[model samples]
Target: MKTEKPISEGIMDSLQMKTSFKDFNSLKNEADTLYLKFQRMGFIESELLELKKENDSSYLADFSLGKKFSFLKVFYSSEDFTKKELQQISSEVDETYFILSFESIPLSLKKLTAIRNQKGNAFARVKLTDFEKDENENLSATLFIDNGNVRTVDSIVVKGYEKFPRSFLKYYAGVRKGKIFNQKKLVAQNENLNGLGFVSAVKPPEALFRKDSTTVYFYLEKQNNNLFDGILGFANDEETQKLTFNGYLNLELNNNLNYGEQLLINYKADGKEQVNFRTKLTLPYLFSTPFGLSGELKIFKRDSTFITTEQQIRATYQIDPRSTVYVGYKGYESSNLLDEAIAGTPIDDFKSQFFIAGGSYIKPQNRKLFPVKNAILLDVGIGSRKKDGKSEGQLGVETTLNNIFNLNYRNSIFIQNQTSVLFSESYLVNELFRFGGINSIRGFNENSIDASLFSLINTEYRYQFNDGIYVHSIIDLGYFENETISIKQNLYSFGFGLGLNTKAGLFKFNVANGNAQDSDFSFSNTKIHISISSKF
Candidate 1:
């Protein structure tokens, strides 16, 4: 007849396998295996003490204390333990061990060190050790949730602010109570809040269980107003034909207002002086209810070389919860960069000024085609242009489908098309930048095109570095047909190189190869650009 025994009795019996001989060597061997397993799971030598075997001819043992956390002991003893009995013993041991707790533990450490796996005597720890501590000893927490599922929180309890509502806290929550939650999704929404440049740090919700059901809570820290920033740099440019010194001032005013604003002004000089000024006022909560409003004005002057001014007003209203519908108006006038490139005949002779007013509906999607993170965008714009005896309106569509579907990597495909009037042009083909420098056909020259309905299919693959720098490889393909130059020269180019896009604007340096038709006519096209924009 078989007799039922307590779990401890079973464990103690297993330890007594060499009891008849009291084999210290066999006992030490088993202890050694257990020690190695613990060590692999991050328990160091200092955390272990003495391990001893019982003197009797029985399976029994004990370990001295020094473990990082408290533990419970279960003994297993069996004269002839079967496979099924060992499996049962393991299940019982695990179920018993997980309930043990240590007192006076930091919450961060507690949350990250949960046991993830146990194979016999071996185990695995799930989270990284460094994740538990912040620079100031503040606890770091992470909460993961499935995409597209809503969670309800009864009330938000904040500790730092005296003039905000629980709902206002929801804005800072970077998540909504009834909205679906996904880790990447929440981060994107919170990033918008961060872009407002008000909060110093924002953290996501922590999943907790009360009575066997799961819930989430968020924690955040806000920075005070009056922020100051500066930048200084030296650059040499082949396009500008000058080596220049650059500096700027970035100021944030009344950051804690519904209508937040920033001021940016910069100066640059090589053999001459240039000044650029830009400012924007944003209404984060325009009339409340997830609607936004912003206004921007910019001016640039460079002492008889060039001068330009632009004004814009944009507003976006959230639609379908996960996306927005936006409409904006912008007007700008600027001198042509190729004023001297047009056979040295000042290309700026064509005065250009236009007002663009258009509406677009955008949807945010997760998971992309290919492993790269991308966005899928569909934009349609209608506007009027009054320049060079061409007073006409334009209709256009721009697509960034990669950004919608791929949300975790750096690669994109962009297709932009514009349909116009006041001239008879191809409905589907007007302007196209097939290849060259950075955005499109990469093996060719920069802005090396004539005219038409141009369609550019450009792809860029970018690699990011640790010290705020990145490099990219680009491909550009473009074609244009001028009535004067009847023979259409379709250009293709491939380029690869690096660029520095810091707090400073783009200063790209690349080497490219281009082909106009079957001829291999290419040149080194480099660009040195700068902007003291307070925002990325």
Candidate 2:
């Protein structure tokens, strides 16, 4: 017989052939599946193939595929892309895809395969090497794709916020190093920074990718917080039947000496020879905690009406961005100087000490000017008045709403109602609520109506033009009741005005008509109101 090939050698050859075929088939099947998937996705010119030698243990695959142009075509021209369009597309694509590796092609492909197997077809990677335009000027890119791992944040860098502590910024970022970078969280942090009132502008966080890590950078622009402002205007006092010149001056130092502290000195004078002065200091953070401290001293003196002075110290704790609770101690002293005719009775001086507690909820609009959107304030206090040696309690609530329509036309609606009640053995002129004037029942004299219980509502509709100027119409209703004094009155007023807002303050001119009874309405009793007040 012819020398037969050894049986063992034949068996070895058969096993090698089977293993090689299996490896080649595995790679070919995977490539073919990807190719067909891309073709169905409208990548008409795509191909995938494997090369393997009969005796080699490894195989090499070369893939040539067309990049999906549908998304690009929707936003860009086929020949080229505008800068903004390109940036938008790049951002969208980066958010959608994660690149696992840019070096070592085999490892990348292997990792991609594992990811694809685990994630079912939701993952993809496209590496473009060249671009070619077809007869229709449609662009196509050579692509190599595989599943990839998402990039994690390596570090965060903050720039252009020199006044703010780095720790503060990091705390607001609300992220740790080496965590998966999230675009939504970054956007939230940016918005939070903008709302702090210290920053004028904030750029979107930028991600710099390196290998598998992403470095995020935050850019900020700070606003000027140190200012000195003044306001000048005129007012009419119906009680005195005299016209008065009114003016205010304010000095502010904010975020300079302390991180976010503010110091304010304000002085106001009116033509009635009345003067009011106040000094206040605010510390936004107390000992690095979320609590705040504020101290104020106020002095008010009118020639023949009253002389009042108050010292207050308060501590506030922030519950969140929109809420706060505060407690304070107030020492007040007042001397009533009204004549018997004006007061309707003889009144004595009073001294009081009080403990006050309150809370506020403010929903701020996201705008540079006129930031208040909605707010509520409630305060309750219990005290002892030394003049009468009696216990006294007071409650006050105020609410405001603005921008009701949420329209870009700059239309706004505002409503404010305040009620103050006192519990005491006997009512004193200083303790009674006074209603009238521009701040209360417009078209009436300041402090013209005084009673033990008083309530008032002010409603306004405002329309803004250009250059921070606005026109507004207002309605005011007020009621006063005093069973002990047997005095009851209802007052109503309607007015229209124009105002100009400046960085320093707001200046307004108003004309109003008031009537104590429904039948007493006439333009002959019109009142003129003028005022200017500092913003800070």
Candidate 3:
């Protein structure tokens, strides 16, 4: 080779010739490798190599780089493929577009073979046959493709958790019997199943192939995701002039019966004598189908002012493994517990019924105090409310988003945004939405505020020391409209919290103080929250 040759830099780079070799066989093997490399680059297969030994430690070689070949025209040979099979390939991919590197026939052929393999032709073979060479140094040929036997999923076998719900297999894992068998896609199906909180994979996913079908195997084990959690808040009561207890308790059970169902019970109290309690049950994959049902019952008592009872039921359809959409009905009935009605106060009893629709998506993340994961929940309802036998139209909407962004492995930012709205001409204190406390807005008592419309957002910067412990700074901002009194205001809170994850459970503690934008902050407004979540 000479420095002043017609070969371009790319051609020279493509020739990975070594400077020296230990033996004649070593030198010959390198020459053989280069032959295949150049042939893959459309170089003539007839290129010649000449070798000469000059001394004990030196040798010289010359390569006759022949003219490169380009395609005159290419054709896909579907003569042996069934019409149905051809239609399947055409629907998924354009068989004609795979001949991209027309000059490099082998490379193009490799692409064509891979496309077939993905389309259930696991043993397809392709070759350029019936070649006709032209005087211009180009060749025309038919790309004869032999699409081997088509394969489909015959069944799925679970080694460890044989009782796994079949519906979870078809809907959640996206792997169903009789589906197209693509080894590449099947290999990734394990992650979709393992990402679930209710189960874990004990062994690597495996596949067994047969002459006519494919069977995937999963070694799974059930995981306990049930939790019993409690929150304790200490806030000074202005009327009592003493610190009072207010918080919430939650018990959630999941997949207990292996039906992929969930049960939750929650209760909250705000030392102001307002107590809220709710219980919900969700049964997914009804009759081994994508449909599910969820029901909820809620009771709220505003300390002798009013007691409200609400019931809701939703019919849900699993959209994918991680998402679901639901349509539901919500009914509310309220009665003033007060002995006498107070004038100018919207504290009377009322009944409201709503038709609701919503959807939700959840994705799990690393098991850490401040894991970088994502979730979203939202719903809207249009219905009516009756007060003193007077009926009126009402609309309600609610949405919440929780997400975490990781700046690095140990550092992250967690943000949550929530909005709730209830629109009606007339207002009732008992029917307005309530959001406060450590969960929604720190430094405020649970269920302390009543609003017709409100938007709240929280941003927390966190540093995880390890899997168990993390520290964070909390910042919250919100705007609310209290339609009862026609007053609107902005609220803000600044705080710091620490979270600990242990074998026993997870614990979080926070110290925060907040106030409305129109008011002055007070150290006496400080609130402390401590919570623990234990899972079984």
Candidate 4:
């Protein structure tokens, strides 16, 4: 009883031998003899076979493999067959493997008669059309992925913005809608909307799948959060033979008024008559609650020696966009006008009220500017101060560290360290830990060392020549201590600098020559230090 012709008559006899192949070179010699019969059935060696000659009534065989060995020999089965004996030897080698595996070769005989009527199916669903490859090549990838079902996230569009605030870009793009379509959370929400400095580009989310979800769009590019910055500087202080002129001005207002609030105003001047004024306000989510708030008012003067005033208020908590934690309240006042031939010397005059705590971690390699590759800052505090009415007890500690070391793509190697301490046995000359010139210890004189304790270290080796120009070579080391001027000091400096990273920030010029000693190093002193700054 050997009679069984019915899977729709074997798909109508494979569509009549797929329309009697009109000999295009005998259908490329029967597709190179069915590519050696699918490599003798174990199918491996493939060099992306080709045949093309598609005009004279068809013949365009271009078979390819290596999408994981062509889905394991086209959906597996070959240890001497038996996936129903490899579907009866793949339906007698699927008409010469659909005339050498298709380029629409008569629609691959209706996909080889639907894989021989889905024979002994363990898995089958092959749909490939014009695939592509060579993405920094490991070669084997002619697109083939078929483990289905799992999409979700149906809806999230958000193209270009005008004034930001689609609830602050869906609250910093922690993508929501229905979940599950996470490609590493959409590339970490496009790097948290390009680190939100009013976003200047964020693309890469375009999803769109659909038969039950996935719509994601997100393309953004917005910048210009209103800012104005200015600075002009000139210096020459060879052991205080002074000749300095510096000026700065800034005004900013980010996020329009959409509640991610920010506003700043600053002014500085110096030709040795130093003056500074500041005003700030930042809110970034205080009431919406991811906690953040800032307030500041500072006024500093430095002619006869000091005149500082400050009022700060801070609160911050963002534990993740690179860490932060803060707390603050500072109300200060210092007014020492030196000159009574330095009367009663510890540089006096003060008023205080402080309560501060700080934290910062920042792991930035590039996020706008600065030579940051890693940053850490810490602050400790305790306070209670009242000048003449006597109340005392104050303590403060500060620390900073930065390290960078990429030695390619324009070389780098920077290290910075700063340390401060004040245990107040009467701490005022503008809170005391001063360190000298051009951002500290640069061959002295600018706040020329008077300490409660201080330490500084800077080492640099930059070298970038384009895009925000750079050139550096610096080394500075300083240490100062004061047990009420029983004093101990050490300073060493070396330098070279030229930087200009702008959009309105980071401009520098430095020159330093060393020497400063005491603790009986015979009271040494050598000079040469120049400085300039502009950090918008």
Candidate 5:
């Protein structure tokens, strides 16, 4: 009696012999007759082997006294029964006591004893799940579309890839199944094909199939752009002296294309005996468009009989991208005879025409120490005078407000109004109401003064530096309304300046001192101004 069985009682006796052989309803008609005489043999259940007779009609079903048998030999045992009736004869009806059979195997090796060698045999062995199912059954590929397009994969055979990577299956095979397959625009044309700085990312390798069209390959990387600059400087104190220079170069195209188109040129020199020449085409994003269309065009020349032609056009209707409602048109023509004696009329064919078909309503607010102080601009116009027909039929209004503190500097307050209507019967110019220079009373000059109820109280201080230097200071008080009667005529002025801005031109060096005395002090006391690139 050698005992040792507790692998959970041999797995509960192999689940009680497979539930007693499926309760053998007679083995379902003997399972095709015991599967053809045990086709590959089975039933290897051995135990009780204590036999002794070679007699008694041939009895010898024993091998010492092992005692563990259950019964096998369906019919070839031949032991007449003596071994004490072969242990009471119940070895499952030992037809003749033959035992030891085997062929049935598989509950994953019932207690697996050991015996391997079958997959194409010769000592067979090779399988980590068949090398991961031959690398998940590799498919084969090649594809690209950086726009120049390419996709061709004729004969790419695949059953299973041996460890992947034949250049990553020829990059997911884009096309080659007879060529010409968009494969869905090869990853968005390789992410918009870019260069110099770098950029790219697009993926879709395989599995968008008609049959199996796999192709993908894109790997790229670089991206940077935004550079800017500006400069200006001008000098003058007369006595045949001077300095002028302005510069700028920038490129930040398509920042939403924010209305940009620039290329301007300007020139000046007192040392070179010449002082003006300009060309321009600029679109500073039309102030901010949504319904705004701004415009500018210019051509200028100097010393060669002074030449200048300028134009400006504008339109606005934001209504709320930050408030706005505007309409504008401006014109200025010159043949420089000192810009038509400072645009006071000899325009040597220098048509001095002014326009302002106006409409304005604005509320611009942006503050961080007065980024735009605050705005409220309202204007109107209707005046024409060519070679002096003085065909005036003009009515105007202007209002400005400001508040700013430090960092360079800023301060401003202004008010205005002008009315006129005289198509000539020359009552020595009977209808005229006006202000001063630089677009109105900046220390007096243009139109000096005329009465019919004019009023102005101005104060300004401005400064800037770094690319386009600037400086401004002004103080003036004006009043008028004595058309041969009623008293109220007062005037005063004081000005200071220095400015030079470039992307092709803008220069001013001024000094003024006025108390009116018939005005026109040839630029108050001293002046020098140049606005090239035709005042874009």
Candidate 6:
């Protein structure tokens, strides 16, 4: 297999020569086959210069392998891009071939035909002609482009769900009329659409290319993304020494009118004293425009002590298929109902107004479940706070991230973190951030903790016996600081749970024990939670 001047390494290994031949003619034929293989591999000047019979069963093969030839020059024309753009691509190809020892001609030819492919030429071909080889083996050839036909998108037809939103075709699927036909992007159309959670792919998208226009077809069915969820908790009160019942309910509606709109209603009655309610509405792609509008309202009461209300309105724009940016105004008002000031600080009425900005990115996860979504959200506010008739500047920030790593078909690990902070000279009791329970740290009473700043990390390791049955272990850690009382503490909790997916809903149950600030775990302090979430 060794020749006079080898083109490069690994070329001999690439030749599929017969190790044992029946006769001398068979050996010659094998050697001849290698020449054609080398020629196809960019050694265009490879030839069998000589063959010598060493003995009855031994032979020496000699060959003249030419310098590896790549595209020293390529000439072509395209209707989509200008001549200068084409020259820039050609110049890039020229730089790719330095000494021309590697066979990369096909890859360069792929680059040559890429523009036409993106410009409605799916079957474009590059034919090299008038090849001229110099003494140094540098070859220059003309590349004649054979662009089959122009295919401009005429329309996108939704088959299964005929009433599916048409605007999503252009904004989400990247398909529209007069747009150039691209097979690669079209092949990925189902993935792009599924990311929005509006619909599931019945099959891959299809294309009907004709001389006049190209028609893109989408086979999809609407998904039941609208959800109703509830969580129930039972625990023993350390002070009261009695069993307590608490829980939360959530209702969300999405794409009801097929315009990608969403409405959420959530309410929580965690304890006898703590009550929370919230509502939000979002309208996307408003009036055939790229902008969206959203409004949110929330109210919280701490049993005859203090009540707080917040309202926000925002405008959103899609930065891409997976991301969105929003800017809005947030307003908060709080009043003392019963509780008095502590630590010599007066608990008075307070109000705040902030201009808020935020962005969100959602990444779909790989999981064998009804819903497989992961997301990240960041929101920050710069505003003014008014307390005791004095106004001061304040900053507020919130961040959340959720990620899932699938180990295999049956196991996974999930991690999520949430942090919220209100930065100011002082904070009122009613205005402080509150968090607890299933949505946050487990094995704790809902809304049982308050702080000016807090961050929580939730980790879960799950094992699935099947798509509908699974078990998981939960470990949560958190830290919070309350500046009003000059207190800071760390929190930790551990728990185990199992889940069952049914036609009515997906149910999960957990038993956990939580401890904070060096407190020892107690069996009486254990909390049990049961949750049911359904999408329809």
TM-score of each: 0.46, 0.60, 0.80, 0.28, 0.20, 0.76
Report the C-alpha lDDT of model 3 over 1-536, residue by residue, as the tens digit: 32223768887787877868888999877776776666666664435356667788876666666666643355554454443544433332244422234444555466657767777777889887776667876665666878878878888898888787778878877788888777776655665666656887776677788765688788889888899987769898787688766877899998889887899999888667888889999988899889989999999988769999999999999998778899989999999888887876779878999999999997755454542278899999999999888999999999999998889977988999999999898889899998888889998877788999999999899898888799999899999999888899999999999998878789899988988988898998888988888989
Q: State the lDDT of candidate 1 residue by residue for 1-536, as single tens digits.
A: 01122234643453343323346687667665554443333233222345433435444434432323232222222322323433432333232221212221233233322211111111223222322433554332222211221233333343333333233334433455544324445445444443333443246545443442335444545545454445657777657868765665556564554234333332323224455567777665454466677788876555455556667777756554334556777665666443345342332422223344333433333221122233344445455444566655555444443332222355333333222222223211112212223444455333334343344555456564533455656565656554323445666556565655454443456655666667745354333222222333
TM-score of 2: 0.60
Error of 3 at 58 (Å): 2.7
Residue 150 in model 1: shift from native, Å?
A: 11
Off by over 4 Å in 2: 1-157, 165-198, 206-217, 226-246, 336-343, 388-403, 434-451, 482-484, 501-507, 530-536
**Whose lDDT is higher: candidate 5's or candidate 6's?**
6
Give the range where candidate 3 is weakest over 10 consecutive residues by summed lDDT: 91-100
lDDT of 1 at 101: 21
Q: How well does candidate 2 score on lDDT at residue 44?
A: 47
Lowest-scoring 10 consecutive residues by lDDT in candidate 4? Answer: 94-103
Clashing pairs in 2: none
- The TM-score measured for candidate 1 stands at 0.46
Q: lDDT per residue, candidate 6, 299-360, as tens digits?
A: 99877688899999999987766778999999999888855555644466889999999999
Candidate 3 at 178: error in angstroms?
1.2
The alpha-carbon deviation from the true structure for residue 128 of candidate 5, after best TM-score superposition, in angstroms, is 42
Distance from true position, residue 335, model 2, in Å?
Answer: 2.8
Whole-model lDDT per candidate:
0.42, 0.63, 0.79, 0.62, 0.38, 0.79
Arrange candidates, best TM-score first: 3, 6, 2, 1, 4, 5
In the range 11-97, model 5's lDDT, one tens digit per residue, is 334323221234335434333333332222322122333333454343332212212222223222222123333333223433443
